[model samples]
Target: MTILIALLSGLVFGVAFGFLLEKSRVFEPGVVVAQMQLRNFILIKVWFSAIVTILIVVTLLRELGIVTLHPKPVLLIGDLVGGLLIGTGMTLAGGCPAMIMAQIGAGYRDAWFVVLGGLAGLAAYLTLELLLRPLPADGPGPLTLAGLSGTPFPALAVAVGVGLFACVIALERLRPWRLDLGAQADGIHHDRPGSPRRP
Candidate 1:
């Protein structure tokens, strides 16, 4: 039942993603690349807006007793290592996991490789985790950014909010697309590259 629910939720989210991607007209290479090049700041603006919204919503909900925030461990070293690996992989692949799925939805046939790569990555993570189960539970217990900073929860949240706002402000003034999303698509769409897209 949990598996079924998860699968259903994934499908629902995929449909929603498609609807929004189409509605926003952001699936177009021009939009994605423009955001990347700092030409248009759609990516930055939307993400920072989302981060701020989530922070506010979660904070209010926690204060209202409508939700519980179990502060998770902040393994700074693990995070730094994982982020570097993921960043390198993304740079080489020219697309992250989410973008791969978006391309697949956009009728890109080569996304199969991306899907395969994602599955392989997931499997490797699971395998490594199982092999090294002793480190996670025993190593770091209930670490948080606040714990590191000795700051109150609200202070940490405010810091995060300010950082997000600053990033959005910085992105709002970018010029135009420098790296073509379609080119990064890696021959995914054989049609007119960087063409004016309607859908």
Candidate 2:
């Protein structure tokens, strides 16, 4: 019963998140490509806001003893190389893992190639494990802001979240992306087939 509840809740949250992704136009290839090219900053702002929100909620829960924070093992060189590869792939494909699904939901038939390419990459990584084994895993392990700075994690999270949120706000004030100006007041970007929405 607990497992079933967890699955159902996960489904609900996933659906909600996907809906938001589509609505935000983060799923749009043009937006992703533009962000990768440093021509647009809306995607960064959106992610920054999300990170702040998550930090606030998670920090509160952990502080209240309602949840425990599990820090993942850090492999600096492995992460750096993996991040480079993933970023390159995202730039070329114009979609990350979640955004690929969002693109499919938004009716982009071309995104299927991105999904297939990702799956193929995963398969290649699994099959070529011996060749990839040389990527170093030795690094300063699981260091968090609290551990490094001697502050409570929750306090550190709140401070960082507020600072980041403020920076995003300032950036928006300085130069905002005008993706939503054309959106309808009724909240429907487009209703007809072949018409694009700003989400």
- Model 2 clash count equals 3
RMSD to the true structure for each prediction, in A, is 5.8, 5.5
Off by over 4 Å in 1: 1-6, 21-41, 123-138, 174-199
lDDT (tens digit, per residue) of candidate 2 on 1-199: 5999999999999899899987777767767777787656668888998898888888778878999777976778888898999899988988788888887877778989988888898899899998878675577778777898999776778789989989898878876756432243211236447767546
lDDT of 1 by residue, 1-199 (tens): 6999999999999889777765444554445555555444555565678789999889888878999888766555566677788766664554556666676787878767868887898899898987655544443667678777899877889889999898766554443222223444331223566855535
Give candidate 2's whole-model lDDT: 0.77
True-structure Cα RMSD, model 1? 5.8
True lDDT of residue 144, candidate 2? 77
Query: What's the CA error at residue 95 for candidate 1, in Å?
Result: 3.1
> Per-candidate TM vs. native?
0.68, 0.81
Worst 10 residues of 1 by lDDT: 179-188
